[model samples]
Structure formats: structure tokens, C-alpha cells
Target: MIRKWAMRAVIAYFLFGTAMYVYLFFIADTAIPQMYKGTSADPATFLNARELMLSEEYSNIRNLLFFLNKPYQWLFYYLILLFGISAAFERWAKKTSKWFSLQTLIYLFWLSLASFIVTFPFAYTSYLFSKTYQISTQVFSSWMRDQLIDFWVGYATMAVVVLVIYMMMRKYKKRWWLAVWVLSIPFSIFMMFIQPVVIDPLYNDFYPLQNKQLETKILSLADEADIPAEHVYEVDMSTKTNALNAYVTGVGSNSRIVLWDTTLERLDDEEVLFIMAHEMGHYVEKHIYKGIAGYILLTFAGLWITAKLMDLWVNKRGKIWKVEGTANISSLPAFLLITSVLLFAASPLTNWVSRYQETRADQYALEMTEDPAAGVRTFQDLTRAGLSQVNPPYLVKIFRYGHPTMLERINMAEEFKQQVSEE
Candidate 1:
């Protein structure tokens, strides 16, 4: 019965995904709006023929991967449950230790290792594609090292979360999800606070911006915007990728305005200032705090729904897929599967919120800098450097994009210019 349901779900998921992919990629009208057709916002004016071709191919591949990844993960979890691997791992962990926490850790280790191995092919393929398109500059060894770091860090984080959730489940039983949700609020804030100071330094070297002149200029902009930024840090991104980016991260004293070295290397001072102004907008507008609030609210609802679904599933298929209930360490895969599905379903809404915030930041940058020309040039350079699509299909924007399309950004800059001219 479980196998039959799984097969049917898989078929339906793929069929729907394929239909959407065909409509969005091949049938959707992705042309630039008529208002911006002949203006500087037009992509053809900035991107060369080869760049246009590459951007299209790159965007298509990325969109295809986005569509396939979730279903592939769901299938993986389903197969593990069907084949009794999760239950077997639980049994093995029990044999290793009498301590419950130890058993949980052991089970998590096996699960994490298995997941890493299973997903490595996808990760490597993504790297290969990026390398092919000149998006990634890191050598194979460096990439593998980063992948290992990611896996171990992820495993550790998962261990902590699973331990907490199971502890709540064991103690509270019926109201465990509520207890976990309450605890997650502070835990999430703490993680965000420490991430910039601790976790980020592990991946790349971050230091004060090397060009003192540029740093002074960025700091001046931050001051003008009342951003409370003391320093502009630079990360060594050229060692890993050619992408240009800048952002404000952390909260309170840990707050940082970080610029990728590639951004400084590729863009002129004025363009870089526009980027800095944009990041400062995120900070000054309190987007991070708002984002955390939104996350906490969503997690509260998501956990409540997940708990209900887990209860229903365990009642019906507990003996078939596992040896015990939700509190069982073995049920981790089931918990993950439910959460993953919810997150995927929530992508469109989350992306829309993110895009809205990003658009606001762009407007703030324009208002603060009052340099629409620099904003336009900055966005154009970003598109060229990243080979990003200027006008992706509606579905792609809805599901995947967290920022406005390139054309939209350029058009906004042009409009800002016109507004300033009239004033």
C-alpha cells in the first residue's frame, strides 16, 4: 500500500513539475516590458550576444535543477523509510550505547553520512556546471573541502535540533511541538547573532576593506544613512567565485558591512558605494529583525502542522515504516520529509517577501545616494559578472528569485533618474 502511494505521488509530482517547466521555459512570454524596450534598461544594450546566450542557458539549467531537487529529496526519504534503513539505523545505534543522547547522536551520524553520500552527486554536478559557466573559480580540492565542511556543520546543527525536539517530545508528549517552537525563537536569534562573528570566519578570510579610501567612502555613506556601521569588511571571494556581492549581516555589535573582494575589483568606487548604500538600506530599514519575526511565525505554524501530520502518519504506518512513534530517534527521516515538503510549498510566498524587501532596499539606495547613473551601472555590471537573466519567466521569479529581475532593477534606476531630473 505504501509503495503504491509512493509511486502515485511520484508520478503526479513529476507530471505537474514537467508541465510547469514546459510552460514557463518554452511557452511563457519573458520579453521585457514595452516601456523599457528601447531604454537603457534593455538587456541587449548592455549584455553582448554571447553573454545573452550564456545567461539564458545558465538560468534554464538552474531552473531545471530547482524543479528536480525537491522531488529527488522526497524520493530519497521515501525509499529510506520503505527499505527500513531508518529503523535499522536506530537499532544499530541502540546496540552501541545505553545512553539515549548517545544513541540519538549515533543514529544522526549514520543518517547524516548516508544523506551526504547520496547527495554528493548533485552537489558535484552543480559545481561542475558553475565551473563550466565560469561562475566558480575554486579548484576541485577546495570545493571538496568546502563540501565536507558544509556536511559536518549541517550534521552538527541537525544533531542539536533533533536532540532538542526529541527531548521536548519525551517530556511534553502531546505538546512537544509547541515547546520546541518556543525554544526555537531564542535559539534562532542566538545563531544569527553568532553566525557573523563565529561561523562565517571558518569559511573565508574577512578583514577590514584593504583599500582604505574606499572603506572611508563606504563608512561615510553608512554614516549619512545613520547605519551605525564602523567598518566595511572585505571577504576573499575571488578565490572561490567570480561573483560580485555585498551585504550587511549580524545584529547589534556583531553587525558588519561586508563586501566581496570581487565586487571591489570589478566595480568602480561610485558603483560600489551604490551597492553599499543598498546593503545599508537592509540594515537601516530593520529587515533582519522583521525577517526573524516572520521566520518565528512561520515555524510556529509549520511545526504545528508537522506535528499533526506526523501523528496521522504514525498512527497509520508506524509499523510499516518504523519501530515506534514520533519520539523515536528513528523517526528523524519522517520529520525531515514533512518539513522539507512544507518548505518547498512555502517557497513562492517566502520569495515574494524577499523580493519585496530587496526592491525596497533598491529604492532606499537610490534615495540615499541620489546617483541613479551609478545604480544603473552597478546593476548592469552585476548582471554581466554573474550572467544573470534580466527577465526570467514569471514562475521562476515566483518560486526561485529573491530579488527583482535585472531588467526591473535597471528600469527602477532609470525611473529614479527621471524623478530626480523632474525635482
Candidate 2:
């Protein structure tokens, strides 16, 4: 009976994945219109930029990525396939007390293996570009080694936390929904604090921002913007890649501005200042707090709905499954399935919020900086440096991009320039 159920589980995973791929392939173009339909400074130019990206000349590189897209997608599907297989096997083993602990280990091994395989390629591609362009110092091999180490550490840490949550849910089987809420909220906080202090350093070297003059300027800018900044630090971003970036992280006293070393190397003083202004804008506008608050609220709503949905699902599965909770962590396959579906549905909502915050930051940066031209130059250089598509389909831009496209940024800056001239 267990063997029969295991086969059914494996086949179901393949079918679900296939269905998802089919749905995306067929409806992706229809699902979202690309450019910001919402009122902005100018819709005509925005539409032009969107149209340009879809043009063959502008999108050649993006089109080429499609060559690898399928293979990458298949790799993901197969990783999930492996995960489902192991999960089914684990469930069978769970039937007997003697095999329970051993099966749990086996389940963890496969879970780690699947996650590693899925994340490795993304990490590799990002690493390769950074190193090749001198954006990062780490070679391909070294990056791979580091990734492998990081993978196990991360996988072990997350798995242990999840296992504890699962145990709680199981213990309170009658109140599994309540258990999920209680565990997920604290778990989210645990994750946030751990990511910066522990996980981040494993990937990149974090040190005090080395350029004293630059640091002072940044702090002053933040003060001017009425954003409190605790520390200004630099990450050894060049070690892994050369892509230039600056971001503000943490909140209140813990909040700091981290400038990528590569950003300093590539940008001139004014350009760096403009970049710093942009990051500080996020703080000044309270975008971080708003985002976190929004996430917490949404998460609670989503979690409640998910718990209820899973409760119905668990009940449907009936006496055949002796799991304690509506959402069993040991039934990792089902957990993955449900989460993937929820994330897929939530993708558009997530993208919209991110784009809104980004645009707000961009506007704030313009308001804070004395040099709009510097912002313009920085955005232009960043676009050229990254080989990013200047024009992209409105649908693609809307769905995939977090930041506004290069063309859009330039257009917006030009508008700002016009406003200054009129004044």
C-alpha cells in the first residue's frame, strides 16, 4: 500500500510541474501588460521604451537567455522531482517506529540536495559575470566551493528551524493552524536577524566602509534627508562579482548603508554620492518599515488562508496518513506543492509592491540630490556596464524587473531636468 502511494505521489509531482509549465508558456504573454499603466510623468516615452525592448535589436541578449531558460527550468523541475520522491519514501518509512529517525535523515539529505542543485546555477551565473568583468575577484571554482559550503550551512540551519516548527505543529495536531501562526511569526524574525549577522558574512566580507570621506558625505546626506543612519560600511562585493550596488539594510539603530566595493571602484565621487542618496531615500521615505509592515500583514493573512486550505487537504487524505498536522513538514512534497502554488499566485502582487517602492526611492533620490545629472549618469553607466536591455517588453518589465528600466530612469531624470529649467 505504501509503495502504491509512493508511486502516485511521484507521478503527481511530474504532472503538476508539466501543467505549470504549460500554463506559463501559453498565458505568460497575456497575463500582464509591461509598462506602468499607472499615471507617471509621461506615458508615451515609457511606452516607447517598452516597445524598444521588445524590438529584435534591443532584446537580442534577452532572447538568447531563452536558450538556457528551458534547461534551467527543467533542472528546477527535476530537483522538485527528487524532493517528491524522497518525501514519498520517507512517508513509507514513517509507518514503523524503527525507521522513523532514519527516514527523517534521508528526507533532509534529499531536501538539501534539491535546494543546492536549484540555487547553484543562479549563484554560478552571477559569480561568473562578476569575476569575468572584474566586478568580483573570486574565480568560478572558488565560488563554487564557497557555494557548496554555504549551501550545507544554510540548508542545515533552515531545516532545523523548520523541523522544530513541524514538531510543534504535530504536537498541537488539534490546533495546527494556531501552531503555524505562532511558529511562522517568530521564525520570520529569527530569519531576518540571522541573515545579516550570520548568513551574509558567509557570502561576502562585511567591514566598515573604508573611505572616510565618502562615509562622511553619505552620513551628511542621510542627515539632510532626515534619515538616521547608524553605520556606513562596505562589503567586499568585488570578491564575488563586479556588479555595482548600494543598499540600506536593518532598521532604526541597526540600520546602515552598505556600499559595494565595486560601486566605489566604478563610479566617480558625484556618481557615488548620487547612489548613496538613492539608498538613503529608501530610508527617508520609510520604505523599509512600510515594506516590512506590509509583509508581516500579508504573511499573516496568507498563512491563515494556507492553514485552512491545508486542513481541508489533510482531512481529504484521511486515515491513510497518520500525520499530526494539517500541513505536515514530513510530508515535504505537499508542503512544497502548496507553497509553490501560493507563491505563483502572489507573484504579481509582490512585483507591484516592489516596483512602487523602487519608483518612490528614485523620486526621493532626485529630490535629495543637488545633481540630477549625476543620477542620470550613474543610471546610464550602470545600464551600459551591466549590458542590461535598454528596451524591454512592457509585460516582461512589469513582471520581472524590480527597478525601473534604464530607459525609464533616463526619461524620468530628463523630466526632472525640465522641471528644474522651468523653475
Candidate 3:
């Protein structure tokens, strides 16, 4: 009987997985193309106003995503409630009910605390595991405290907002998706306005670039490439791991370059110039807006399909586990699961586009710097400084890495150097 029940459970999980894909593909094959058609309805009249027109399309896409996310969020919560109940039952069945009961007692105590009403000890345990493996730089206590604070802030903010939205939708009984889309547009605009200014500062300290010589060199490269930026800032990355990174943050007047302090401390002036030039290429090429535009185009279909699939999942099997989509609170786990599964599903499409984008940036970096050797040194130093795996398996890098592997990058830089030397 136990074995038979296990077989049934396995079958159910497989069916759920299949239903998710079929729903996504069916919706994506229809809704996305229609949205794109809507996107092209009124082409920008002037070249300069094209950005404005595209921005409108982007807003529409985000609005659609807001509606899509509601049902997806519901399914996500249902899945988590199912998992929690299953875990509790499994413990009870193993004659470990006493220990499980103790855990629940502790959770109840924590949940009752007014200040720290967020009880997500199991989620905190995952970060602890990461720290144990040296993958996460945060200490266990610090990680736990950060998680608790984050959970409370996010939970409180989202609870009030979601409740208001739900009540409004329920009371009016108009197309809730349409209402959600309307509400989401302004929220999206607010995010666009404040993410670089307000949100990034909450997580990391930012300071103006202090090294005059290095800063001057970077500025010169940007000037050469015709990338306009008023200032560069150094970010305190030493507080975390030794990974090297740099990016152009913000849009329009808020735009500025941010470099990880690790990059400055570890890389020489020339290599740093090359890295800056690469980042400047991103600006000159307008890759940031381009990236946002790409996501805006895709997210409409992605979220709608996600919502439809989650609804199907809830209808099919959620009740067996007493998991109601609308009432459950632990929805993030389901979102994470579906996201992971979809990432795997869309790996080929995403990977191809990513590799192409990286290649284009690399080409621009080579052209902008006029020194392929600097580019090579920059790549090598970054790899060494970060202790990167030099030759990851192709499948691993293809799916996991956004950038090319260390060896692939080094070889590309070397090829550019050879071609330049011959010229």
C-alpha cells in the first residue's frame, strides 16, 4: 500500500509538471505575439520620440505582468502550504513527532513575538548551509538577523498592498487583471525613478571614486567612446566576497558608473581602463535600455502563462493536500520552484541571446580600448582574483554562467591581440 501510494504521488507530480508546460506554451504561443502586435500598433513618428514610444510599450508589458503575477502568486502559496504539511506529516510518520512538535512550538513562540513576527527558520537554514559551504560570505547569526529583518519589512509592505488590491478587486468585480494592469503602470514608473537612487543604497555603501588618476583614465575612455557620464563611484564590495564587478547604474540624469572596490584594489590601471571601457560600451551601445526592452517584451507572455498554469495546478491537485491557492501565505517557495523549472525550460533561448550579447560587448570593448592586451589582462586578473573555475564544463557554463568561461574569454582576448599585432 505504501509503495502504491508513492507511485501515485510520483505520477501526480509528473502530471502537474506537464500541465504547467502545456499551459505556458499554449499561452506564450498566442498572447506574446498579440502583445507584440499591440506594441507595434502606433510606431513613433520621430526618431528621437522612439524611446518614448518604446517606453510606453514597456509600461504596457509590465501592466500585463502585474495581472499575470496575481494568480501565479496564489499558486505559489498553495504549493508551499502543501510542502509544509507534507513535511509535518513525514516527521510524524517517522516516529519523530515529538521533535517536530517541539519545532512547531518554537515557531509558534516566534510567530507570537510582536517585533519579530516573521518565523521562517527553515529558509534561514538554507543560507546557513550556503555559509557552511563557503559560498555565502555572511556569518550564520548575521544571515539570520538579516533574513528576519528583510522578511518583516517585505511581509508588512506586501501584506498591506496586496490586501488593498484584493479588496478593491473583490468589491468592484470588474476585470481584476485590467485593474491590476492600471495600478502596476505607476508602480513600475516609481521603480524606474528610485531603484538606483534609493534601493541600491539600502544594501551597499556607495562613495565617489577617490583615485584621481584611475578616474581620469576611465573618463578619457568614456569620452573617446562618446559615452556621457558625469561621475564614477566606488562600491564597498569588500564587505562581501572578492568578486570583481562594474556597471552603469541608473538612467538619464541619475546615470553614473559604479565599480566594486575589489576591482580597483585588485586590477592595475590599464586593466581597470579596459573594464571601464567595456562598461562604457554598455552605455554607448545603450545595452541597459535594450535589456529592459527585451524583458518587457517577454514578461507579458511569461507571467500570463505562469498564472494560467498555477491556476490549473491548483484545480487539479491542490485540494488533496488541503492547499487553497487564495488563502495560503507561503507563496515564495512555489514561485521559486516554477521559476527554476521555467529557467530550465527556456535555457536554450535565454542562453543563446545572452552569449550573443556578451560577444557584442566584448567586441565593443576591444574596439573602444584599441588595446586587446589590456582586455586580456583584465580578463585574466578578474578570473584569478575571483578564483573562478578556469574551464567549467560546457553544459554547466551554458546554463549557469551569464558570461563566457575564463578560458573562452582568455582565448577570445588572445585572438583579438593576435589580429591587432598582425595589423
Candidate 4:
């Protein structure tokens, strides 16, 4: 009976995803708003006919993948539980280790390996699509190496998270969710603090901005913004892709303004400064700290809800699933399945907050640089370099867009230009 239900759910999910993709790709109106039809903000104003077509195709494909990935992940976990694979993993782990933590690690390694294998196709397909679109410059061997690194890093991180959660469960019992939530606050911050110095360098080399003259200008901008930034670092991204990006990352002493080498290579000094100012905006506005706070609050609520759901599910179906209770090591997939659904459901809220912050940064950049022309041109160049859609489908904008759409950004810059002219 459970197998039959799983099959039906999978079919329904696939069909619904297919229908949504078809509608968005073929039927949705992805054109720039009528208000900008002949204005400079029109995508056609910057992108040629071929570029526009490619951007739409690329964006649609990306959206399709984004929509499908989460549900597929949920399905994977569901199948693992239904087939008793997770329970079997538990048995194997117990046989291998008398210690609970060691047994947990053994079980997790097998589970993580299976997940890695299952998800590799999605990652490869994304790479293939990017390669086809001339967006990826990476060779197959380099890409595979990166994939291996990602898998191990992911497994290690998951190991820590699962160990902590399971340890809390063993000690706190029904109150484990509260304990895990408390610990997660510092864990999240530590990850952010170390990510710039520890995790990031494993994939690419980072060095102080080689262009001293450009770095001086950026530092001057940072000073004006009251940001305590001392150095700007550039990463070697040219070997991987043609995409251009810049960002603010880390917290406190680890805080950094990082520019992709592609951004420096492709953009002029004034444009790069505007981008720097935008990143500085993030620091000055304290978006990172605020983001952490928001995450902590959301997780507090989510974990509480998850505990309730886990209890309800385990009490009702734990026997048939070959699970003893919520505290069982075999219940990790079930826990993940619940959290994944909650995360997906919460995406719109998170994305909206992110977009709001991005918009403020754009505004801050314009005000600080007082170079609206450079801002507009920089955005246009970004769209061209990345093959991004100026205006994406509404649902895509809600679920996937952390930054404002290209059309909105260009319009903001143009408005800034107009306001300065009046002044």
C-alpha cells in the first residue's frame, strides 16, 4: 500500500512539474513591461536578437532545474525510508561500531554516498547546459574534481550537523529540537566566519587585488561608506566561467570584499567602483548580521514545527517504515524530508528579504558613486556577460531571484540619473 502511494505521488509530482515548466517556457509572457518598451531599460536595447533568445532559453532551463531539484530530493528521501534502506544502513553501522557516534558516522557515510550518486546527474546536466550556452569555460576533468571536493565537504558538514542533532536527541529526548536550535545559532556563525578563510580557498585561489590603482579607489569608497574594509581580494574565476560577480562575505575580521577576476577583466574602472560600492553597501547596512538573525528565528520556528510533525508521523507510521522512533538514526532522512519541504515553502519570504537588501545596495551604490551612468552600464554588462533575463516569469522571480530583475535594476539606475540631473 505504501509503495503504491509513493508511485502515485511521484507521478503526480512529475506531471505537475512538467506542466509548470511547459507553461513558463512556452506560454508565459516574459517580455519587458510595456512601460519600458522603447526605453533604454528594454532588454533589446542592450542585448541583440540572438543574445535575447539565448538568455530566455538559458533562464528557462535554469528555472526548470531549480523547480525540479527540491522535489526530486524529497522523493529520494521518501524512497529511502519506504524501501527500508535507511534502516538497513543503521544495522550495518551498528555492526561496524559499538560506539554511537562512530556508528552514526558510518551510517551517514553510506547515506551521503548514495545521495551524492543520485544527485550527480543533476549537477552534470547543469554543467552540460552551461557549456552548451557558452557560459562555462571549465573542462570536464576540472569540473569532476570540483564535484568530488563538493561531495566531501558536504559530507563532512552533514556529519557535524547530524551528530549534533542526534546527540541532542539522545540527551534531551522530546526537547531535542530546542537544544539543537540553541546550538545552531553559534554553528551558523562559525560556518560563516570560517567559510572565507577555510572552505572557499579549497576550490580557488584568492589573493589581494592585483590592480593596486583600482584597489585604492575601492578603499576610498569604503572609507566614505564608513566600512572598515582594508583590502579587496580577487578570485581566479576565469578558468571556470565567463560570468562576472562581486560580493561582500564573512563577518568581523574575516569580512571581505571579493571581486571575480572576470569582473575586473570585463569592466572598466568606474564600473568596478560602482560594483565595489554595492558590496560595501552590504557591509555598511549590516545585512550579514541581520541575515543571521533572520535565519535563527526562522529555524527556531521550523524546528519546533518539524518536531511536532515528526512525532505525528512516527507515532502513526514508524512501525511500517521500520523506524523505532524519532530518536532513531534511521530517522535522518525523515527529518531532512520535513526540513526540505519547509525550506522550499519558505523560499519566497527569504528571497523577498534578499531582493529588498539588494535593491537598497543598488540605491546606496548610486548615492555613493554619484555615477548613475556607470551603474546602468555595469548592470547592462552583467546581463550580457551572464545571459540573464531582464524580466523573468513572475513565479521564477518569487522563488529564484535573490536580486532584483535586470529591468528593475536598470530602471533604478536610470531614475537615479534623472534625479541627479534635476539636482
The number of the candidate with the highest lDDT is: 4
Where does candidate 1 clash, by residue pair? none
TM match of model 2 to true structure: 0.75
349-390, model 2: which lDDT tens digit per residue? 787888778877888778778577887778766764554555
Misplaced by over 4 Å in model 4 are none
Each model's lDDT:
0.88, 0.63, 0.56, 0.92
Error of 1 at 28 (Å): 3.2
Model 1: per-residue Cα lDDT over 1-423, one tens digit each:
877877887897789779877876788676778877777777788988899889888878777777777777887787788768999999999999999999999999999999888878778888898999999999999999898889888888888999999999899989999999999999999888988998898789999988999888888888888777777899999989998999878877998889999999999999999998899889878999999999999999999999999888877778998758888988888889999999988999999999999999999999998999999999999888888888888888888899999888998999989988999
Ranking by TM-score: 4, 1, 2, 3
- Segments in model 3 whose C-alpha atoms lie over 4 Å from true places: 1-79, 83-189, 321-340
Candidate 4 weakest ten by summed lDDT: 24-33
What are the runs in model 1 whose C-alpha is more than 4 Å off? Answer: 1-6, 9-17
TM-score of 3: 0.65
lDDT of 2: 0.63
TM-score of each: 0.97, 0.75, 0.65, 0.99
Expressed as tens digits, the lDDT of each residue in 306-403 for candidate 4 is 99999898788888789998888999999999999999899999999999999999999999999999998999999998998888888899999999
The candidate that achieves the highest TM-score relative to the unseen native structure:
4
The candidate, 2 or 3, that scores higher on TM-score is: 2
Which candidate do you rate higher for lDDT, 2 or 4?
Answer: 4
